[model samples]
Target: MASSIPLRPLASQSELQAFYIGKDINDVPKPAVILDVAIIRRHCAAMLEATRELGVGFRAHVKTHKTPQIAHLQVGDIPNTPANFVISTVLEGETLLPLFQELFRAGRPVNVLYGIPLVPSQVPRLAHLAKQIAAGSISVMIDHPDQIDHLRGFRDIAGFAAGVFLKVDSGYHRAGLPPDGLNKGGLVEKIITMEKEGVIELIGVYSHNSLSYAGSTLEEGMQFLREEILGCREAIRQHTHLLSARQAKGKELVISVGATPQVVSIKGLLQGGALSPSRHELKALLHQEDSDDIGRITVELHAGVYPILDMQQLSTNTHTGPAEDEIAISVVAEVCSVYNNAERSTPEALIAAGSLALGREPCPSYPGWGVVSEWRRPKGPGRLIVQRISQEHAILGWEKGKGGEEGIPLRVGQSVRIFPNHACVTGALYGWYLVVDSSREGEGEGERVVDVWTRPTGW
Candidate 1:
């Protein structure tokens, strides 16, 4: 039996202000994670606008900002339509299930996709949780045939069928099944057969092209997307007979693609004419018609890190890079010491944030763990970089020849905001995000703690 978990009390605005308002970045304790709620709202709006323009649905991946407040922003104010959302963990699904249920009860179409693949041992708990909510409200991902059998056995015991989406390998080569080529593995056929046999209801197909993130140019990302769509189409083509059988039963298919880089690239391509052919191909795939000339297929995009822009997002833009001001989250650290190199040729300042706080993810575009934000020094040279990070200390260094005679002229106790390489991992390191109002004016004086949003960490 699972133990009931009590909900944490939300801190009142006045209570939060007593702890955070009027305190300067330097004075609010070191190595703290701060979130600009205003900026987050702007990012959410931009993503929704792009998806709307592209004529596709947006399913915000809550793995980045694992808070209900942020998730509410992603879903928007009107809850009439299903607020399409995805989660990376069962715990996250459990955490957000009640909210989704409440929305569903209020006549809102709410759907939650537990994006991760599952095993037999985990099916009971997931099924039990799913049973508590609206029928078909929760969906799971499956990439292999045996997992389907496992799900079937669990369903027989539990007396309820679960909705599942096929995880296709869209150049990520990680955990999904290959969508293209001959169906020698018979995965698609098996899935369709199982659906017909009432073992599991096939909800859709999902793909995550991670290669898009490492692609050097925007064209590369588009090419990957093209291949992904082609692959999905090929899968459907090979299983045409099976699809026809399923479609006759009034079943529709969904093509879900994600990864922040690809989502942003697709949005850019849809806006610009530079890649007309690719753009047209994507639109056709997204707006595909069936034999009866009905738009039976729907395209859903799932991305997590866009809500909190980081160094990786900026470098991966490949087009008009995001302005530094758009980055909403930052690690505020205080300088504990300053020292010279062994040869005394360069000086380095040690701060409080490190791998434990900012994460150890590599920033290939930047020289260090993270780049120093120009929030405080808008006109000053943005030369400071987190060159190295220990368990609890981040060593800050300036670009070669950019530091003056005394090496950046930094003093102990000085505060610096470090924008992490990956905001998702960095955000996971903290317990609560100190919400700041970016719309406020002046140097941190008007910045008040509007709320204290707690983050759901761990598995």
Candidate 2:
């Protein structure tokens, strides 16, 4: 460990102690999204391997999991290591600077981009902060031609060319320049022209593959760039004569192609009978400079998985409960009302496990539903009941056993915390988490708790 940052402000040791054990907040009931550190490191290593094989730089975006501890690991050692990072929000950019400073103190250089913000008032501060850190290397994205007006006078005011990357749509209609269109040279021409005029330095051409959009897949993303890169190369070639005409000059241009998903998936597209290089060869290709001609660029895999582990561990017990199953999480709630006295007046009680946070909606997971845990209801006892889930809350109900008793009983003050099917989103919803350890049961490593870490919320 290279000296740990002070944990005081980042998290409270005592609260951390209580969180891991899956304790409730105040006297009211509460739940947590547990994270496993080992699981995150495993995924990070896998992503790094995939990025390296694609002949592009691997600058893990820390916006997904905005934890300093994880960011340090992703950026490497600086001067001795490569410091390439892609941040989404300004807050993420600010938070990352200190981590970079730490690396600088130890003799490392950090290069990072907090994507690009369209608003006008943001440019100056971003530029200033970039200058403050070692290898500050701040870059932003530009999509439309008119947006450049917001940046007008930037050259006169800043005195230095801004590092910028042109945003290519790449089949994802979310935001960026379409791979091809009448607006063909729209944003790209403006950016390159600005660079030629010394307003901003066009470092590279990049794309954002909004997988959630139409025609955006790993293959589509790569193929889209293949054409765009070829197109841009031709555009630049056409400019050769114009260059001589205007006596203009610029260095070789580079294009950066990737989204977190496609970045790792396109590594094997060129493989064949005997014409393909081994994975190791591809990794080497991506890490080298001046090698951009070989379709090389950086891929952004924001550190989403890392946070799932280093933050909190979801609690899952395999033991049987007093109900029909041993490993089920039972919830008891009153029927309140049942339309035609169809049900009892007693508060409903049920075996609650996975809830809406787990991606289960319209209908919640019924019995035999297991996530993070593998438990089942027993064969000999209480009513094995499962019911629907409400937004932000779940309602479980059950009738009495084989006997003549009424429905299961749960008082007004009783409640149970559930383990989420997907822990990542759940983790993002809270500012801090309660932790508990399996080995120590109630004690060990002081109660571990994690603060709600995140990148800048606004652009």
Candidate 3:
């Protein structure tokens, strides 16, 4: 994908939206991608106000920037957070069916889950992505016991029955089944004999600290989201006597937990959602979450680069505070050449976004693969990072003692933003997303271009 790999947009979405929407992200072309949209609505409304202050329930994964206007700002237009999506491709849940059919015509009822696992050629494309929301809104994700006979052979060829979750691997073995092997792992009694033969429809118990990006602080990411909510409430307390009690409660059971550095370390709590008395066991499971039954269990969280944060989520310092105030995606690139490192004279510059547009991911905090974004300059004692990449080249330098023997000040067509090191692999090599908006109002307000989302490419 080279010859000047412009991943997409060979113009024509009504001429690139009549030529670069509101125009600016360096007036387009140069490894573009941009995004921002007011820090993607302040990091998806601060992760839905920290899961409504720990009452919890919020899925929103969309494989990072699969894009439907950031999956409608990670499901918000809240009517008490209705959309629960999770999709890791069935064409990103059928390209988010027109934003879940316009949140099922505003009365809001969207649900999709199919995050992955239970693969019988993805059951007729999740029975055609559950023919549009509602018969238990298409969930999936199993951990074995032959995916409960692949959902009882997809309820014997789509007569309906695809709503499950199970998946427990609390320690991130990658997939699931391990909250102490959920009651002797017969895959939870073959998913409790197909949810007592109604075929399928369990929907609860998912886990995923994905090792909280090897967290560095914020109480080791709130103790890995308090051990992913005590490993999904210890696999939903080992099936409260083989299920069936309105099939579980706590807003009807869904104890999910996932990564984004342990769900953004619950915004380092304190200030009402409290928590730090040496964290009394994650403050009695996230600030007395209503005192028990894991608070009626609906603790979901799932994440996806929490609205475009990167640099390995600011090197997982857990409370990702400042990377130009929470990254929110960037690439823009240009300054194609200005070298000087002959045996370490240290002073470089290259940019044209490498690793095919800023991504070969690797941010053990510093020593780069992208950073240089001083959020539109004027705040630099010494920055400029990237420090070397290849597939389409990068370089940029200066960090060893924050270099400055007075030399590399980049020039050739200067334009730079960068901030990468994995905003979901620098947004899967961009296929359109120039949008911007640092909450506008003056001096380079995040370089104009207020809209052009697109992205919904190959699985």
lDDT per model vs. reference: 0.73, 0.44, 0.73
Tens-digit per-residue lDDT, 1-459, candidate 3: 012223333455566777887777776778787877787788898888878766667888988888777888887897745788888877777767778878877878778887877777777667655765556668888877765776766666567788888878888788877876765447777776777788887777777766778677878877888877887776766566665454444336667777888787776664466455656666466434443433354566788887887777777787547787788788887887786556456667777768988778777767778778764445444776877789987787767746555556667787888788788777777667788787789987667886777675566
lDDT of 3 at 298: 50
Residue 38 in candidate 1, Cα distance off native in Å:
1.3
In candidate 2, what residue range of length 10 has the lowest lDDT sum? 311-320
- Residues 1-459, model 2: lDDT tens digits: 112223223445455454444332212234444343333444556556655555445566666555675677565443565566777666566666678677767765566665653556666656655655643366667767775655545444455556666666655566665544314445655665776677776655565553411232444434443544444443334444333322233254455554433443344444454533433343343344433232223333333332232111111111112222221111222223222122645334433223534334221222312222212222223433334455554544432323224333333344433434333344445444333222334443322332223323233
Candidate 3 achieves a global lDDT of: 0.73
Clash count list over all predictions: 1, 37, 3
Best by TM-score: 1
- In model 3, state the lDDT of residue 403: 59
Model 2 stretches astray by more than 4 angstroms: 1-29, 53-55, 134-136, 152-159, 182-186, 212-252, 266-372, 375-389, 395-425, 433-459
**Candidate 1 lDDT, 1-459, residue by residue in tens:** 134545445665456667876566656766888888888888788888878777777788999878888887887766476687888876677767667777778787767787777666767767766677766666778876667777776466446667788888766788787765424367667877877777778877888877777766676666777777667666666566656776776778887887777777676555645557767787677666454532266778788888777887777764354546678888888878887544445677788888998999886676788887765543334468888889988888875435555555567777788888889999888777887887887766435555677766765
